[model samples]
Target: MTPEEITRTSTTYNLQSWSKQKGLNPIPVKGGEGIYFWDHSGKKYADMSSQLVNLNLGHGNRAIIDAIKDQAEKYCYISPSYGSEPRAELAKMLVELMPDNIGKVFFTNAGADANENAIKMARMYTGRYKVFSRYRSYHGSTFGAGNLTGEPRRYPLEPGIPGFVKFFDPYIYREPIEFASEEAASAYYVAKLREQVCYEGSDKVAAIVMETITGSNGIIIPPKGYLEGVRKICDDYGIMMICDEVMAGFGRTGKMFGFQNWNIKPDLVSFAKGVTCGYVQLGGVAVSKKIAAFFDDNVLSCGLTYSGHPLACAAGIACVKYYTEHKVLDNVNKVGKTLGEILEAMKKKHECVGDVRYIGLFAAVELVKNRKTKEPLVPYGKDPDGVMKGLVGKLAQKGFMTYSHENMILVAPPLIITEEQLREEMKKLDEVLGEVKA
Candidate 1:
């Protein structure tokens, strides 16, 4: 089919997620290379958000592609019960990369399923029902995972399943009151969370699941000692600390995992995205030694038919190897510093740019109408004016592909992106920000 035909067929026959059907226009992507993808018309767009922040190794990684092909030739699909070399090998590699506390892996198709299974394990292990997540979080779209999600996207999924509760995120930039320091803000927020947990009856709460460093909702990195506080709270109450590393895992934050930045070990870690670097669909829940020990005797009670598909596992193994051999994490740190410098310059130059939050390549630029009031360029969950949308449209027209949530522009390029490529792409971003009126 022609590019136009393909676009028409997709919009007409397929249902697009989280979008209105009317006037939906999507670019007909032809092909991609490292950090960039081309449309049918040959317009190349830099993938700054890494196409939903999953394509960590970037497009067209030869190693991962070859691994997928090799696995498919050997065995396309295998029962999760069967012992597949790729599956077993990948699982063992994950265990080694993760903290010593995490002992086992339960593979799933993607992040949503990983979270779904994690919730199930937490509840079964603790014999409790309630699960706590932050209001600014996005877990997944599936029913169980959707309920665990705390964002407005969960609105349509309501009245959601029972036993899921929401709490405030430590969005320091948007804090109502001035904090003496980030530590004070962290202490205050943790205290409030502890109070809420108590009010809900701590014994009944199974887990407190969180995106280690908030992803799409804005890269709201937890204050120093904040995650440690949560860990302590979970430890004191026997509540499982579930870190949802769906978007933040696999060297996104210059670390192997987001929670690694903090001195804490979650009881369970739900990961996806970078596991296979979007080469193949794969995600899994990593259990702490304690939880793995409990499951040795107890029934785990959760699974998917294609839990650990050979192709996905092979892709994952290759991706991990590529990340290690290419020194991808080091690049994330090196290039990430340049990214921060560029973003800081944009903030200094643009009136619309309010706050910049970044770690490694994971970053967000919060837009504002008035810097003094900190009034967002687009209000929370209400974008009637289309101001931010118009700005993003400008960026796309210039071949810079990124996304905005509320008033924040996410700036997560593939881990393999070079300093030169980042600067060029971010220059386009700077031009787009200039289009925004203060």
Candidate 2:
């Protein structure tokens, strides 16, 4: 089909997510390679946000495509009850990549279901009802995962599930208090969390779910000792610590998992996105040894029709192999350093940039109308004027593609992106930010 036909068909017959349909002009992407994808009109775009930060291996990876083909030829559909080689191999690779405490894996179709199963397992194992997540988080949009979510997107699920609780992130830049050090800030947030847990009844809390690096919602890195403090709290209350690594796993954070940066072990780790790098949909919950052993006698109550699907598992195996063989993490650390430096310079050079937060290629630039007062370019969840939308559109016009949340712009390119490519794409961002009227 032509570009116009594709757009017309999609707009007429399909409903897009998180947008008003009438004026939607969806890109008719024909093909992509490396960090760039082109529309049917042959206009190429640098995937600065890695297409929702999932396409970490980037577009058109031959290994992933060939793996999918190879798996399809062998036989694709199989019941979850039967063991498959690709499934077993991928599961083994995942467990090995995870921390020492993690011992088993349960696969799912995507991140949302991965989180849903994680919550179920937490509740089943702890025999507790309440789960705590931060207010700035975006877990997923499924009914259960939506309840796990804490942002405005979850509002439609209001009067939500009975036991999900919300808390604030230790966003030091936005915090009113001026702490002397990161450790001090960590202490304050941890103390408040502990008190909140007490009020919520510690024994009744099943898990403390957190996005290890708080992706999309500002990339809010935790202060020093914050994660350790949360680990201690979970230990004290016998509450499971669940890290939602959906967007932060698979070398996105310069480590295998985001929690590894802080050297903390979560009882349950939910992951997706980067594992198969969007070549095929896949996600899983990696459980600690204790949680795994508990099901030895007790029933494990989670199930999915596509659970451990052989084709996705095959893609996952190849993806995992590509990560190591291509030294993806090393590239992330190297290019990510240059990304950080460039963003810091952009923050200094652009009056509209209030703060820049980054770790490994994952980052966000918070836009502010007034740097001194720190007034956001658009209010939280209230960009009624389409200010951010316009800004993102401007970047897109320059062939730099990314997305914005509230007043922050995401800058996560694919993991396979080189330093030169990063600098080139980021220059578009620099030029766009320079045009902002702030």
Give the per-residue lDDT digits (tens) of candidate 1, residues 36-88.
Answer: 99999899999999999999999999999999998889989989988899999
Candidate achieving the largest lDDT: 2
For each candidate in turn, the TM-score is: 0.99, 0.99
lDDT of each: 0.93, 0.94
Kindly report which residue pairs in candidate 1 clash with one another: none
For model 2, the superposed segments whose C-alpha errors exceed 4 Å read none
Model 2 pairs in collision: none
Error of 2 at 419 (Å): 1.1
Alpha-carbon runs more than 4 Å astray in model 1: none
Root-mean-square deviation of every model = 0.9, 0.7
User: Native-vs-model 1 lDDT?
Assistant: 0.93
Instruction: Name the weakest run of 10 consecutive residues (lDDT summed) in model 1.
Output: 385-394
Q: Please give, for residues 65-181, the per-residue lDDT of candidate 2 as tens digits.
A: 999999999989899999789999999999998888999999999999999999999999999999999999999999999998888999999998987999999999999999999
lDDT of 2 at 1: 87
lDDT of 2 at 285: 97
